[model samples]
Every structure is written in C-alpha cells, then in structure tokens.
Target: MGEDCNLHEQACAAVLAPGVAVTLDISPKPVRAMTDLEFTVSLSDRNGPVDGAQVALDLSMPGMFMGENRSILSGLGNGLYQGKGVIPKCPSGKTLWRGDLQVQVGDVTGNVWFLFSVK
Candidate 1:
C-alpha cells in the first residue's frame, strides 16, 4: 500500500508519465468519516492543465473490505474535476483509507492511490 500521502494537510500527488502528474485534494480539512467531502482531482502535463477527461475515485481501506465507495467527478475545466462523496466510519476503528483515483483520457486509463486518515 502507498501510505505516503497525507490528505489532511495537503494534496497528495503521483506521477503518471515523465511530465504528467495527478493530484488528489479533499476538503474540509481533517477528514472525518460519515461526512460529506468535496473531492478535487487534477491532471496536468508539461503544457498545462489537461481537461475533458473522465475522472473518478474509489475509497477503500488497505487490507480490509469496506464496501463500494466511489465518487464520479465532473470536469470543472482546466484539468480540475470535482465530486462529492462520503467516507463511512469503520466499525473496527480503522483510521486509514485509500483514495484510489482513476483517470481516463481517451482509451488510456491511469490510476493512483492517496492514503489518508479519518477522524
């Protein structure tokens, strides 16, 4: 598991290609479970912000099953996509969750994971 991202303090980013990168930003800060969250996903390249792509994110816990929590985002132009979703609180008191961001441009698809903790 890629447990390097801290989505509470800042946006976590991962590279797809040499100059292409994807970032996952969530708010309001100090993410908590069973609350509405605004998800902002961005894709950029050497030229600039890449737009007109289908973007979505699947929220899950590493090494555990937490049902299906997916957020399908709409393009807000300039490579930024926004969506709303909720993170369900775990019964086992698990704080760690993974935001599996999926980016699709044309027929090509890419994925990146952002690890975060819920209060």
Candidate 2:
C-alpha cells in the first residue's frame, strides 16, 4: 500500500496484509497545541479518495468525576473530520484536565491523550 491507499479495508481484507503499508496521515503528529482545532487527516487508497467510508472521532476526558466517556465528532468532506463544540479548556488547581482522543477509520481506530492547564 501507499500513502494514498485505504488502510481500513486493506487491513481487514488481508489484501495489503502482513504489514503492507501505512496509509492515513494525521497532521500535527504530537498535537502540541491547537486553537481552531482544525486538523487535516489524509486517507486515500491507491486509486485516490476512499470516499463514503465511515469515520468516527471518540474523545475521552480524565479528571471528570464521572470518568472517561466517548464523544462523537462530525465528518467534513475529503477525508477531513471536524469535531463539534469547543474543546475542553484548560483545567484548574494542581491537577490538569487530561483525556484521550480516538479516531476511527472503518474497523480501525487510533487514539492519543491530551493534557491542558486547569481552568
């Protein structure tokens, strides 16, 4: 597979199996800081554009009395996904607000955690 290949189906179908290639690029690897929170994720097959595949964004926030949970984000056109509402602001006190972010592409999902100052 190539950068433009669809890893979702390819991963499951075994067509590009046995560690074929890693497609999908989540820009801003570390996700240091984002204001607009507008990020670009590239998902394309060798043919170009996966088109109409289900993508989901799941968010988990720590330090919440309720505990971690899943938040659904909306999808933009062309392999771009946009999260709704304002992201959790900086936390307050000695502890900071921490949470995990998960991105799903078909049957495959990836995740990362983010921490911010306490508000």
Candidate 3:
C-alpha cells in the first residue's frame, strides 16, 4: 500500500489486517540492485509485539520480469523477523521494486504490498 512511500530513507508501516500491523525496514540504506540486502519485518498491534508468526517476503520488479526471488525469515522473538535477499539489477536501469509480504498466524493470514526503490 506504500507505492508513493520512499523506504530508502526510513522505515514504512502498513496495516495487514484489522488488528495486525506491519513495518518494513531495509538495511544498507539507498538499497542497491544485484546486492545482498537484509529485510526486517515487525508485526504488532494494540497489545504489543506478536510472537510465533510465520513471515515470508517476495521481491519482484513491477512491469518487468525478473524471475522469482523469495526470502523466508526466521522469527527473532517479539514479532520481529529477519531475512536476507537480493534483487537483480534491471537491464533497463530501473530501480523500482515491490515486495509482497505474507504473514501467517494460526489460521489467519494477511498480505501487504511495499513499494521501494534501489540505486
């Protein structure tokens, strides 16, 4: 839901469900293509950090075919999950990328779209 948001400068947040919220942060600011990148996803609600949730992120270039790149993140307690992935550099020199984040807790599932750019 953050197509106009610039995650390269700071963390961005989105609502995944009625009480579930998600925040995304990318390390090594000014994210670059064809490089290893770290993704941090935080899930929480009014009650505080959620725990034991499964999180997966899929990265792809919009309006372009870049193959399938998915990252499975490990739970790090307190609803914080971390994973590593890489985005291939587009031959057309485009830096815009989109992440499809899926969160599963018990039988409930939530999804969100995150728009970001790379160097």
Candidate 4:
C-alpha cells in the first residue's frame, strides 16, 4: 500500500481502538527543510502516561516519495518519548509534510498525524 493509504489506515485503526491521546511538541516551530527537527511525543490514556510503549515517527510528504524517513523514539519516563529527524526538501517544491506518530503498547496501537510546513 502507498504511504498515504497506510497512514489513513493507521488513523482509522487508532479511532476504532481504545482512545489513546497523543500530544506533540516540535522544537523551533516553523520547521525548515534540511534542518534539525526535534519532537517529543507524549502518550496518555484514561489512567496516565503510557510508559514503556514503543513509539515511532514516520515523516513524509503526501504523493511525494522521498524514501522512508522513520525514527524510533526513546521512551523518557512519564509517557514522554523523544526523537530527532531532518525534513528533506521536496523535489516538487511542496512545503507541507505529514508526520505520523505511531504508538504501540502491547496489543493496543494508536496513531496521530500532524501537518507542518517547511520554510
């Protein structure tokens, strides 16, 4: 399946599964291409931080292939995960990119998508 299709599937699965709230914080807002991008993923459920969960980030531009830019995040206690990655410049000059944050804790899985522009 294409990346876009896969992303849609993940979003749907996340909705159908138990609610998993995700909060994202990207450093140096107004992210620019070919630059360092740091992000923090915070996972939480009904109880509290979903610690020890496997978290990963898939960064891509819709309809644009720039290879697979995936990063595995390190769990920082209290439901917080951190990772860094660089946004590649789009050959088509598209500045908008989609970030898919996938979280998996045992049998439960959740996904969150965010749109950001590259200067």
Q: CA lDDT of 14 in candidate 1?
A: 93
Query: In candidate 2, which residue pairs clash?
Result: 4-44, 4-45, 5-45, 90-119, 91-117, 91-118, 91-119, 92-118, 92-119
Worst 10 residues of 3 by lDDT: 3-12
Give candidate 3 misplaced runs (Cα > 4 Å): none
Q: Which candidate gets the maximum lDDT versus the true structure?
A: 3
The Cα RMSD in angstroms, rounded to one decimal, for candidate 1 relative to the true structure is 1.5
Per TM-score, what order, best first? 3, 1, 4, 2
lDDT of 1: 0.88
User: What Cα-based lDDT does every candidate model obtain?
Assistant: 0.88, 0.36, 0.89, 0.73
lDDT of 1 by residue, 13-118 (tens): 8986567788888999999999899999889988999998889999999899999999999999999999999999999998888888888886658888878889
RMSD of each: 1.5, 9.3, 1.1, 6.2
Badly placed stretches (over 4 Å) of model 1 are none
Writing each residue's lDDT as its tens digit, candidate 2 over 11-71 gives 1111222222122222222222223333333344455544444434333345355233344
Higher-ranked by lDDT: 3 or 4: 3
lDDT per residue, candidate 4, 17-110, as tens digits? 4667776666655567888877788787889878988889899987888899998899999988999999898888888788887888989877
Query: What clash pairs does model 1 have?
Result: none
Residue 35, candidate 3: Cα error in Å is: 1.7
Off by over 4 Å in 2: 1-70, 86-95
